[model samples]
Target chain A: MHLVLFILFGGLCVAGAVNLLLQRHPINSALSLIVVMTSLAVLYLLLGAEFLAAAQVIVYSGAIMVLFVFVIMLLNAGEEERTTGSKAAYLVGFPGAAALLGVLAFVFLSQKSALGNARLGSFLVTTSDLSRVLFRDLLLPFEVTSILILVAILGSVVLARKEQ
Target chain B: MNPLLTFLLLSILKVAVVLVIFLTAVAYTVLLERKVVGRIQNRWGPSRVGPFGLFQPLADGIKLFLKEDLMPTGVDRFLYLLAPMIALVAALLSIAVVPFGGGQTYKGVEIFDIADLNIGLLIILGITSIGVYGIALAGWSSNNKYSLLGSLRATAQVISYELALGLSLVGVVMRAGSLRLRDIVAVQSVHGMASWNVFGGFQFVAFFIYLMAAYAETNRAPFDLPEAETELTGGYHTEYSSMKFAMFFMAEYGNMIIVACVATLLFFGGATSPFGHLIPAFGGAIVQAILPVLWFVAKVLAFLFLYIWVRGTLPRFRYDQLMGFGWKFLLPLAIANIIVTSLVLAIHG
Candidate 1:
């Protein structure tokens, strides 16, 4: 069951991410990103990060992606204009991307012995467990991230405000 | 029986039952809304299709199914077709977590609900949030200016109100100390109606905030700016016809029922009868099993009536006014309620 679910959602996440890059229209890209986020959320659930999974869906796919879609609609963004690029650029980009993937794969494979297999129903992370860690161990980081968000909000408001 | 197989079979059975009852409830809610609104306007509502319009929903369903499914030119065929299904599915999915009554056993089999996850409330919030995409895509896919505008308004309105909705629920969760709907209800059931979060936890403020935000979340009257018929024609569903249009209607009513059920479970003692303590003599197994379910259904019905009553009474808010109310008024109020609740909880503890 675990292997089947991992394969299904992992494949979907990759497909969705590829679709996000391939889609010409901004709305289509936004929708693809939502699919990727949702698939990631399922993966999070499978790994026993239940709260994180819910937050991923609620905050990322729900709120953030809605804003992205809203902006795309408000701006009436159309399909991306295709442009021809130099052939040499593709040669360098493909090889560079492949090299990066290879390096990441090597790193993951090297660490595989240290990682535990995720068994279904073996671990369950509750909300209280998450809150305990956040409030006790990561309090400072949480506060700082919140403050950063506030600053971003203020900056957006100021930027969007009309001149008197 | 194998435990895993039993669990799967029971879950499938529960899902089937809940879907059947929920669809029927949604169909009747539409009838209820029309009849109530008609009476408020001093008109006799649809009495022609069976007694007191009881069969109106069935007749309407048949009509919609039989009608020509129109596909307008220039529409995004895939997304336009997919949108209503998204709305209806998300709306229906939220019902899985809602506990209709206390846990029960029949013939040595236990059933609490369809699937009561520990993080049930958050799951509902997550699913409902995704529901926004249905309206957004529907409007965008229709390729009509009116549809696009309506969906834009809907997406903005839903997102703004969703913050307040989630914030308002925080106080209830804090008081319960668990995310499970059944646990929240159990906390309130211990002390009966007086200890309900609405009355005892000083959550009247949160309850009111939730009520208003829920109105906007479900896009009901006064907050129904997305489909403001006078301004945006049919709004996000302007280009949809036949069964596709019916799907959107079912989705909206389903959402209303889900919100009402959530409010009841969180604030109104859920399936716990107010007189459960007083009537100890009548606490036979049959009475114990049946009364709570009746009480639960009663509370949900009352909330649904209130939804319809408000619809009949209030005029729709202007677009700017609606946004201002959600962000400027409800958001601050919800935040303040949280602070006050936390302070009180800390002092009491």
Candidate 2:
């Protein structure tokens, strides 16, 4: 069952990514991005990271993508011009892609035992357990990250505010 | 029966039953709103269709089904057609995680909700976030200025309110110490009304903030700037007609029901009776299964009535006022509520 779901959503993720590139309209591309994110969340679920899956959907696919779609819609950026590849692009692109793929495959092969048995797959981390890890074990990082976000928000507000 | 097959069949059956009941409730909620609002305005509402207009929804359904499905000129055909379905599917998906009755299993299958997940509340939040796409896409695809503006307003409003909505629930999550709807309810089951988050938990501020934010999130009245008929016509659904328009309508009412259900579960102890142990279990397994469900439905109905009541009495917010209220007032208040809740919990513990 898990394998079936993995194949289904994994295929969907790849298909959405391809569609995102092929789509001309900015809105259409944004929507395809949402599909890719949602499908990736399903993949996260297949690995039994339920909390991560929910966060992926809520924060990334749900919130961030809504902002992307909203901005695209508001701007009404017209469809992109269809352009064939430049002569220099097809030359360097293929080998670069191949090298990247090669590196990924090498890393996966090296990590096969750990991926098969432990943290990478077939383990459920309940919400409570995840919360403890975040609050207790990773408290400093979480607090620092939040403070960084607070600073960024304050900067944006200051920039946007008008002087009376 | 084989275990997997039994589970599959039972689940299909559960989904079918719950969906039918939910759609029926959505339909009647429209009738309920019209009737209640009419009475509030000193007029009769739809009394000719059946006994007290009970079959009015059936007539309305038939009318919508028979009406022409239109695709206006120069619209994005694919997203235009897909938008209402997206709206409806996202609206319906969250119910699978809301526990409507006891944690009872028959033949190794959960009998209350369809999918028994540990992250039920988060799943609902995620689905709601996705629900925004339906309205946003509807407006952008329509090729109409009114639709575009309406959807734009909706997108901004939803995004702003969503932060407050999610934060308001943190206090409840903190009190319950888990994300499961069942656990949230169980935390409030100890002394019934007293133990409810609003009363014993001293999270009334959170509850009120949740109520206002939820109202905005569902895009219902007072906060319903998206579809303000006075200015935006039909809003994001302006270009829709026939069953397509009805789909948006259903999605709106469906969202309203979800907001109500979540409020009931989080603050009012869900399907658990307010009377707690004052009322004994009255009958066999069937009755036991149904009693909590009855309590759940009654609370949801009360919330729905409150929805209609506010719609009738209150006026729509100006766009700027709506934005300011959500961001400046509600957001800070929700944060304050969270801080107070956490501090109290820490000190008491």
Candidate 3:
């Protein structure tokens, strides 16, 4: 029963994603992306990573998608420019995206059973565990990520200033 | 019915009851907010419906139902319809992961209470984030300049604060050593000198950051520039009316309640009694199981009252101030808190 719901939700997510990409209007695309994020949250629930699902919604849907919509709105590019992408861009981007998806699908299919072995269904990632991993095994990467975020902030501020 | 069938039925019934309670709570919460704000402002809120305007929400519901639910002619009809459902679903979904109470035994069979899941906390965060698209879509689909602007601001506010909010919890997660909400409470139950977490050195700082980030993430008062009525004219849902508008309102309050629940669970040893040692007589299995839940609810309600108080007292931040605070101030403080927490934990261990 759980798997059925997962599959149904996942299917909706994938369809929504494809539709999101196809939709010319930026708003439609943003809304569809939200759906995709939601379905992914559901998938996380089925996997028993409830926290991750919440983070997925709060982060991607709440934050990232909002950012996307904000940019679209800020740009003020309405329906007139929605479907104005070049045919060549579509031809190139679609196939490239498809190839990437195929590789991901192949990886996912091969590792499907192994994923269930992690016992993550009940494996809670507490604050301590996160710190241990972050500070120890992932220390360099963690620091690097922080630097990257700082740079992004700097760049956004600079860009906003340039616009002004 | 067979045992399995009976179990499923009972579970469904429980879920139904929870949903009904949440919806009714959402309705009454609106009424409560009006009354509270009115009393605070030295005015009577809604005294026309029933005694003290208790039935105002019901009256409002009827009025909304009777009113024409019209869609703008130029709008994309599908997305326009979908926005509220998305908001409502995302709003209500967070309740499932929240463990309202502890386990109860039946027939010598100990049933792990509160939808006992491994990653309950993560699920709550994930589902709540998805609600952002609802407002974004509503704004965009409405095809009104004000709506678009409102959603754009709201999305920015939610996302920026969300990062700080999630990162702020890393400190608690470090202390608790488990993602499960129950485990967090269990860990919080063991306190040292001074208060629970608010005085535990860097833990207190983390808690403060979490509190502020949560308020911003939920788009509550003093941080609610996105929906500032004077400026944006209703923000993202400027064009929405009837039940659709109600869904957005409910989602906002529901999200607030859930955030408060997370705060209680993480900081105050959710459901555990304060000074469990004092009550030596009641320190048996029953007390251990029951006290934490009471503690948890009390902690959550305290935060809820704080929310109301802030709403009553504080004025909304300017849009620039809001953004600047999150990026320039809160983000850096959160990072520092995370770094400081790890150092303390390392020394103690």
Candidate 4:
């Protein structure tokens, strides 16, 4: 059951990624990105990271992607003009991608002995438990991350402020 | 009966029953709003069809079903069609986790909610956030400037208000110490109305913030600048007609009811009677199951009535005022509420 569900969402995730790359229209691509994010959230849920899954949807697909769509709509961007010929990129890109995939597979295969199998649906980490780790054990790091985010927000506000 | 088959059939039957009741409730709520708003304005709302327009929703549904579906030229056809379904589905999906009554079972199946997951509150928030897409996409796909502007404002308003809405709920969650809707209600059920999160938990500030943010989130008036009929011509659904337009309308009301249910559950102690168990239980198991549902419905009705009253009374906000109120006022107040709540909890403990 778990494997089937994983395969389903994983396939969907990949398909959405491909569709994102293939789409000419910015809004269509943005929508595809949302599909990718949501499907990834399902995968997180299947892994028993329910909090992460909900946050993933709420933050990524919900907030961030909505902004993406909003910007696309506001800008009224037209479809990208297609160019037929990029011979050098076609020759180099495929081999680079293949090599990357090969390297990833090789690393995973090499680490297979060290990596123990995880039984699906057996592992569970509720939000309370995760909070315990974040709020107590790693409180400093969490606070620091929040501060970093605050700084980023201030930076964006400063940058976006109109000249007066 | 075969066990698996029985389970499947029972689930199917349960879903169908719930959907029928829910949709009927949604339809009537619209009628109730019109009637209530009408009465507020010193006029009869809809007395033409069925006594006092009791069947007005039915008539409206039929009219919408029979109308021509007009597609505007240059509209993005796919997203134009998909948007309403997205909105309606998100509205319906969020309600699945809301517990309408106490745990009642038939053949080992829970009767109230479809799924009472532990992360029910988060799920609802996530779904509500997703629901924005329906409006945003509707505006963009319509190929109309008014639709685009209305949708952009709506998208911005919803996303901005969502921050305060989530923050306000954090106080309740802190008090309950659970994300489960049922658990949150149970926390408040101990002392009935007195023990409700709004009163007993010292979270009334949070409650008010939630109420305001929720009004903005669900696009209710005076925060309803997105569909401000005066300025935006028909807003996001401007290009939509017939059943398609009806779908967006239904989605809006559906979202309103869902918001009302959440308010009831989070702050009003859900189906638990305000009088507490002081009123002695009487009658058979059937009555026991029903009494809570009655209480729940009554609370939701009160909330809906409040929505109507506000809609009738309040003037619409300017776009700048809406944004300023949400960010400058509600957001900070909500944060302060959370701080005070946490401080109180820590000191008390």
Candidate 5:
């Protein structure tokens, strides 16, 4: 049951993600991105990372997406046509897509080698254990990351301000 | 702790109770704000829809329920719908790791305590931090400039405050010497009311910073620049309506309660009474275990009331003021507190 559920959500997420590349409308792309996020959250649950799943839904699906939509509306890009990249854009994109697909196919074809021992993959970190890693071992990175965020915030505010 | 079984059951129950209480509180919080604000301005607050406007929130809820569910033309329909759910879910999920009660055991069957995950405090912070994505998504998907700005402001505010908020907790974590909220409370139980970390000089400064940043992180007043009514025009939820809007509002209050609960658990000692008096009086049997839970709830409610009181009393800060206070004031204060705490501990230990 869990495996089937995981597959279903995974498929939906993949489909939504692909749609983002193909869709012309920015708003539509934004909407599909949300689908991808929600589906990914579902996948997290199936993977037994319930806390992570919940966080994914809350952060990515909720606040992050909302910001994207807001930016879309704020820019008023509705009337504008989707930017068409030159042959150079596709030159870059197609190969990128192909490489991703190739890697995915290779993983699918060689599942045993790709996945390794099931037990190795099965190891799950409880929320508490993750917390310890974050608070103790990862303390410096965590603190630095927060400071980085503060800098980004100040920079954005400065950039967004109107000249006097 | 039955560990696994309690984890599952407690997760479900805590989510449900937090959801209901949070939703109800959101409804009343709106009404209370309106009424209180009205009184402040020499006007009656919600006097119409059911006795001193007690039914106001219900009326507002019904209106949101009955309103049309709008899916803007050409907008990202999926994301639009998902935004509110994300917000509500994120807001609600943080409550899980909060240790509301001590424990209840009867003949090998644990009755109440939620998952006794060893890292409860970390779980709470992780969940709350991730909850910001809901607000961010709401802004981006709406395709409205106002909403986008609101979301951005909210994101920046939350991310900024989250730093101070999380850093502020380091003192508590260090003092407790354990990341488990329950363990932290256990440590606090040693000193009783007088010595709760809130009173531990350096820890007290951290607590104040956390409290202020938490108000901002949760987007409460004086720091509610994202939803600044005068400029943003309802902010990120500008385009949101109906139950979706209701859910977002509930999520905000829910987040508020979660923060309050966490603050209580970390600093006040979860479920331990003002002086550990209740534990001895009740005896160390099941009842004694349960007393701590009651004390925890009472402490949490007190903080919630403080949230409301501040909302009632303070005027909202201007955007720059909000940012300056966070970066300039709270951030420095928190860093200093941490330094002081570390030095003191190092010297003493």
Candidate 6:
């Protein structure tokens, strides 16, 4: 059952991401992104990170992606405008992306021997567990991220204010 | 007799029962609203339908079902069709976590709710937040300016109020020390009516904030700027017709019912009667079992009545005013409530 769910949603996530990249219209792309995020959330649930799964849907898919969709709608962004780019750019970009993927995959495969296999219902990540980690071990980084968000909000408010 | 198969079957049975009851409740809620609002306006509403309009929802359903389903020119056909279904489905999904009655076991199976996740409240919040996409997509796909404008307003309104809604619940979560709806209600059961977060925990401010935010979240008056008939016609659903229109209507009322249920569970005593310990002597196992369910349903119904009452009594806010109230007033108030609640809990503990 777990394998089936993983295959189904993982395939969906990959398909959604590919569709997101291939979509011409901004709204279509946004919708594809939402699909990808939701599928990823389901994956998180499968991994037993229940709190993280809910947070992923609430913060990422629910709030951030909604903003993205709202902006796309407000701007009435149409199909991607075609533009000719330097051939060298794609040549470097595609190879660089592939190299990065290869390195990541190699690292994961190498570490597989060191890490224990994940069994269903073996590890449960609850809300209390998450909060304990965040508030104790990662308190400084969490506080810093919040401060960074506050700064960003202040900057946007200043930028958006009307001139006297 | 396989355990897994039994679990699946029971879950399916629970889902079917909840959906049927919920859809019927949503239909009757519409009738309740119309009748109450009509009386508020000095008129008899739907009396000719069937015995004080008890079957009015059935009549309305038939009318909607028989009506012509329209597809306007230049609309995004797929998305236009999908939006209402998405809205209704999202609305229905949130009810999976709500414990309508206290935990009860029949034949060694929990029967009160469908899925009782530890993070139930958050799951409901997450699912309901996704409901915005339905309205937003419906508006955009319609290829009508009025629809577009209405959806934009709805998106903004929902996002703004969602903050207040989530923050308002933080105090309740803090007091209960858990995100599970059952746990929250269990915490209240200790003191019965007074033990409610609203009364005993001094969360009246948070309760009020939640009430106001929930009203906005469900797109009820006086915060219903999204579908202001004076300005945007039918708003995001301007181009929808037939069962598609009914879907949006059902989704809205379903959301209202969910919000009311949540409010009752969180701030009221849920299935716990006010008498609490005193009620044991009144009757046997049957009364013990049925009384709490009656209390739970009664509280939810009262909240629905409150929803209709407010709709009848209050005037709609201006769009800008609604935004300002949610962001400026409700958000800060909710934040303050949380701070005060945490401090009190810390000192008292």
The most accurate candidate by lDDT is 2
Sequence-dependent TM-score of model 5 = 0.73
- Recovered share of real interface contacts in candidate 1: 0.91
Measured with C-alpha atoms, the lDDT of residue B295 in candidate 6 is 91
Candidate by candidate, in order, the iRMS in Å equals 0.5, 0.5, 3.3, 0.5, 4.9, 0.5
Using alpha carbons, what is the TM-score of model 3? Answer: 0.81
Taking the tens digit of each residue's C-alpha lDDT, what string does model 1 give over B1-349?
A: 8877877787788789889999999999999988988998999888899999899999999999999999999998989999999999999999889888778954434454677788999999999999999999999999999999989989999999999999999999999999998899988987688789998767999999999999998889989988988989989999999999999999999999999999999999988987547657476777777788789889999999999999999889988899899899999999999999999999996
Candidate number with greatest DockQ? 1
Deviation (Å) of B278 in candidate 2? 2.1
Ranking by DockQ: 1, 4, 2, 6, 3, 5
Higher-DockQ candidate of 1 and 3 = 1
Chain A TM-score relative to the true structure, per candidate: 0.90, 0.88, 0.69, 0.93, 0.78, 0.90
As a TM-score, model 6 comes out at 0.97
Compose the digit string of candidate 6's lDDT tens values, residues B7-92: 88898999999999999999999999999999999998888888887999999999999999988999988889999999999999
Each model's backbone clash number? 0, 0, 25, 0, 32, 0
Model 2 pairs whose backbones collide: none
Give per-residue lDDT, candidate 2, residue A79: 84
Once fitted onto the true fold, the runs of candidate 3 whose alpha carbons sit more than 4 angstroms away are A1-10, A33-62, A79-164, B1-7, B47-52, B105-114, B191-195, B199-202, B280-295
lDDT of the candidates, in the order given: 0.91, 0.93, 0.76, 0.92, 0.76, 0.91
Over the stretch B43-162, how does candidate 2's per-residue lDDT look in tens digits?
A: 999999989998999999999999998888999999999999999999999899989999999998889889878899999999999999999999999999999999999999999999
lDDT value for model 6: 0.91
Candidate 1 residue A13 Cα shift, in angstroms, is: 0.7
Q: Write the residue-wise lDDT of candidate 4 on B7-66 in tens digits.
A: 678778877887888899899999999999999999999999888889899999999999
Query: Candidate 6 DockQ score?
Result: 0.85
| Position A87, candidate 4: lDDT | 96
Q: Rank the candidates by TM-score, best first.
A: 4, 6, 2, 1, 3, 5
Across residues A8-87, which tens digit of lDDT does each residue of candidate 3 receive?
99899999989987888776777688779878878876776555666677667666777777788678767635446788
Expressed as tens digits, the lDDT of each residue in B1-349 for candidate 5 is: 5766865675676567756765776677677668766776778977988778899888887788999977655555767787788788877766656666655554443344445665566567656755676777688778787888898899878866777887898888777777677778777776578667887434788889989989998898878888988898999998988788888988887787788788887777667777655344745576667676678767877887788778878899877888888889988888888888888888996
